[model samples]
Target chain A: MPRRDPAAFAEFVAARSPALHRAAYLMVGERQLAQDLLQESLTKTYVAWPRLRDHGKAEAYTRKVITTTAITWYRRRSWNAERPTESLPDTVAGGHDDAVTQREWLWTALQELPPRQRAAIVLRFYEDLTEAQTAEAMDCAVGTVKSQVSAGLAKLRDRLGDRFGEHADDLLPPTLMVVTP
Target chain B: MTELLKDTMDQAADSLLAPDLDVQAMVREGDRRVGRRRTAVVGAGVAAAVVAAIAVPSLLPQDQQRATEPVGFAAVFEAHQPSWATGSEVHVGGRSFDAGHQVFAYVQTTEGVVFSDPSGQVWASNGTQTVGVGRTDAEHPRLEADGSRVAWTTYGDGRPTEFTVYDQATGEVDGLAAQTGDAEVLALDGTDVYARDGREIVRWSLATGTRTSLGRPTGIEIEDVKAGVIAHQLPHADDGATSPYFGRELGETLAPDFYQTLALSPDGTTALGESEADVPALADTATGAVTPITVPGYGFFVGFGWVDDDTYVGLGVNEPYQTTPLDLLECEVGGTCTVTAEAIGSAASGVVLPFGQSMDD
Candidate 1:
C-alpha cells in the first residue's frame, strides 16, 4: 500500500497484464473493451495503491476490479442491445479443420453468454479458480457464483450443443452437469 | 459428462495463452515516462520564464489557447511506457509511424505494424512491410503512401506530446526540431510535411526552410479534405478527456473505437471518416452532411485511401485478425459495403494523405 514500490509494481504488471487481458476479453467479448476495462482497473489500482493491504492481493484486487467493472458496463443499457459489428460465426464443431478454427468457435460461444454468466464461466473455467475464488473475484457471494456458473453452463450447453459434445471433455468444467437422458 | 466439457474448456483456455506486450520494453518505458515527465515540467517552467520576458499582451484568450499544447505531439513519441505499447516497436521510415493504435495512413504490406492488443493483430500495412507494431492506445498515425512518409503524435512522459518522422527510402530519423514547436504531422509528402498546431495548418519543407500557412481551420478537428469532401469526426479530446460535443451529440458518446481520420475523395466533394460509436461515416464537402456507412461482417476499417476518385480502399481489421473476407471494399458515393466493422486499432485510424492529384481530379 505504501507507494507500491514502483519496481515491484512494474514486475507485478509485467507478469499479470496478459492474464488480466484474457480474463477481460472473456468478460467483455471484445478486445478494445477488454483493454479499456483493464486500463480502468489498473488506473484505479494506481489511485488506491496506498489502500490495498497486501502486495500479494494486488492481482486479486485488480481482477476483482476488472470483473465488477465489466459486469457493470454490461448492465448499462447501452452495451446490452447494441448491434455487434462482428458477430461470431457459429464455430461450434462439425466443420472445423484446424485448431485455430475450433478455438475461434470456443471464443465466439464464450462471447454469446450473458455478462455475469460469462464472467462466472470464464473465472471458473479459464482462470482455473474454484467457486470460492471466482466468487471473491466477482465480489459476489459463493451462492451467487454457483448460480451464475449453473446458468452460464446451461447457456453454453445450449449454444455449444453437439459441437461441444465432440470435445466436451476439453471445453467445459467437470463440475458442470449436463441435463441429459 | 463433466470431463468432456472440462477438457474442452481447458483447450479454449490454452488457446488464449499467447504472449502479449513486451515486458522488457514495458518496464523500460515506464521508467522513461516517469523520468521524462519530471524533466518536461522543469523544462517547461524554465522555458516559460524565458518566453514571458519578451512577450507583449497575448492576443488570444486562454480558452482559445492551444489546449492540447501542454501535451505536445512529440512528447507522446518520446514518453511512451513500453508496458502500454507492448510489442510495438518504433517504425522509423522516411517518417516515424507511432500513432497510438490507429494508423492514419500506410502502404500495402504483408508485414504491417500490429497494435498491442492481446490478440496480436496488425492494423495497417505499407506494401508487405510493417510500419509499427503493438500500439494499443494513442493517436492514429497519418501517412502519405505515394511519397512514402508517415507521422504521428503521442503522449510521452508528462508532456503528452511527441512526433517522429521515418524516411523509408533513406532510413533517416529526425528526433525533433526545436523550431517546429512539437508539430503533429497531419500529412507527410517526401520533402514536405503538413502539420497541425491546434488552430492553424502549416506546411513545412524539409528541403526548403520555408513554412507556409495553407489557411486557418475553424477548429482543431481537421478533416482530410480531398476530392472536395471533408469528413471530420465529432470533436473529442485526444487525451480521452470528456468535452462538449461540437455537432449533434448522438445517444452514444463516441467510443474510443471510432475511427477519426477524414478521408476526402479525389474530387474533394466527399469525405470519409467514422464517429465515436465506431460507425463508418461519410461527409459532404459542400454541405457538411454526415452519413453512416455500413461496416462488413468480419473486419473493422481503421484508415481509408482513394484507389481512384470514386473508389476508396480501407485498412483496419485486415489479415491475421479478421476472418472477414474482402478487407478491401469499394465504397461509392451513396453506396455502402457490408464489411465486418472492426474496432479501429489505435495506430490504424486516420485519413490517408492526399496523392498528387487535386480534389477536382
Candidate 2:
C-alpha cells in the first residue's frame, strides 16, 4: 500500500489468486463465475489498498470479501453444482481409487448444503481458520459458525455415510504448511 | 483428522482449477484501472472547461447575472462505482477470450454498453462486467438498446433476416422472425421493431408481434429509429435532400452541414453528430447551434454513445482510427471529458478495430 511499492499489491494478488480461485470455486461451484468473483473482490481490495494497515491482513480481507460477496450473490443467482459421474475419472482404468472416490463424493455433497453452512465448513476445515476466525470471516457469532460446521458435516456424513468422518485430518488446510514462526 | 480432511479439500480445489493463469494481465488490468482513476480526476478539470464554455450555454444558461455560477455536466451518479472499479474477462462459448478482440458499435444500456462482433455475436460491458448474446451474420448489423433490452438483426445465409434480442437483467435471449423477403431491420426502440419491406416502412411490436404500417410508400426512406426518434431522408421531389431527419415526431431535419447524427440523448433533444470539424460535436436539434466536443487528451475521431440524458461514453480511436485502446471516455453535458485508457493511439492501447465505422455511422 506504500506509495513507493505498488508492486507489493500486485505480488500479493498474483501469489494468492490461485488459492482464492479454489476457495471461490468451492463456494460458487463454477470456474468462470469463481474467477469473476475473485477478480471483482480483488479489484475492490486493490481500490482500498491504501487504507489497509497491515499488509499481512490482505489475504484475510480478500477472504472476507470472497465469503460475503459469494453469500450476497446467492439471493440473485444459484450456482450449479458439479455432479460426480458414476464412472471414474479417465486416469484410472475401469475403477476409481477409494480415497479419490470418497473425496469426489464429498465435493458433490458439499455443494448441496445451503451457502452459509458450506462457507462455514470451507472456512473452518478447508481454509484452516478456527471457529472464531471463521465467525469473523462469515461475520457471524462463534456459535453460528460451530452449528453451521456441525450441520454441514452432518449432511456430508448423511450423504457419504461413516466414511466421511474417517478423513477428519484431511480437513486441515495444506496452505498452512508455508507459514513459519 | 483435520489434516486428513484438508487433503481432500486441497485435491478437490486442484480438480476444479486450471494449471496456468496469467496473473500479470489481470494485475496490470487492475492497475491500469487505478491509474485511470487518478489521471481522469486530473484531466477532467481542463476538459470540463473546454466543454462548459461551449455546452453550458446549450444545456444551461450563462446569463450575466449568473456569470459567477459554476456550470458543468452532472449526472445522478449517487453511489455509482467509478468507471475504473469494474473489469471482466471476455467469454465466448463458455470459454474466456484470452487476448480476445474488443467489441464495437455499442449502445448504452441500463447496466453497460452493448456491442456486436463480425459474426453477429454481441457482448455487453460497463467497464468490469461482460456477457455475450447469440450470433448474427447480417453484414452492417445494427445494434439498439433501451436499458437492459438489446436487439440486432441476423442473416441466415441471406434468407429470412432475423432479429436477436437480449435482456441483461433477466439473462434471457429471444429471437423475432422479422421478414423472409428482401427487407432490412433498421433499429429497435423499446418493444417496437422498425423494418423495411420493399419501400413500405413497418413498425412491428417485439412483444406482441403485431405489425403497424407507419407511412404509405413514398419517396422518403427510413434511415434509423430509436425510442420513437426517426432519422430518414425526405422524398427527392426537391432535388433530394442529403441530410437525414432527426428527433421524435420526426420534426427537425438534418442540415446539409452536419455529418449525420450517430446517437441521441434519451429525451431526443440533443444529437451526437459529426460536423465539418474533424472531431464529433453535439448539435442542438431545437436551435441551429452546434458545439464541437473533444476528448481532453486524445484528438482522434472516436466512437460515442449516450449514457444518460446528461452524460455520454466515448471510445478513443488512434490516428487512422484502427485501434480502440479500450480507453473509456466519460463526458457530461456541461463539463469536460476524461478517458480511462492508459494512452491514446499507442500500440498497447485498446483492442484492434480492424474494420472501423465512421463517427457518423
- Best candidate according to TM-score: 2
Error of 1 at A56 (Å): 2.9
Per-residue lDDT of candidate 2, residues B114-227 (tens digit): 566555556654334445555554245456555455666666674576666665445566555654555556555666667765566777775575777766545444544544
Give the C-alpha miss distance for residue B328 in model 1, angstroms: 55
Worst 10 residues of 2 chain B by lDDT: B43-52
Quote the lDDT for B340 in model 2. 40
The true-versus-predicted C-alpha distance at residue B39 of model 2, in Å, is 23
Error of model 1, residue A60, in angstroms:
0.8
Error of 2 at B360 (Å): 14
Give me the runs in candidate 2 sitting further than 4 Å from their true place. Answer: A1-181, B1-108, B112-118, B121-133, B157-159, B216-226, B235-241, B251-257, B277-279, B294-298, B301-303, B315-327, B344-361
Best by DockQ: 2
Candidate 1 whole-model C-alpha lDDT, 0 to 1: 0.44
Worst 10 residues of 2 chain A by lDDT: A172-181
Question: Candidate 1, after superposition: displacement of residue B94 in Å?
Answer: 62
- Model 1 residue A6 lDDT score: 54
Interface RMSD of each: 10.6, 17.7
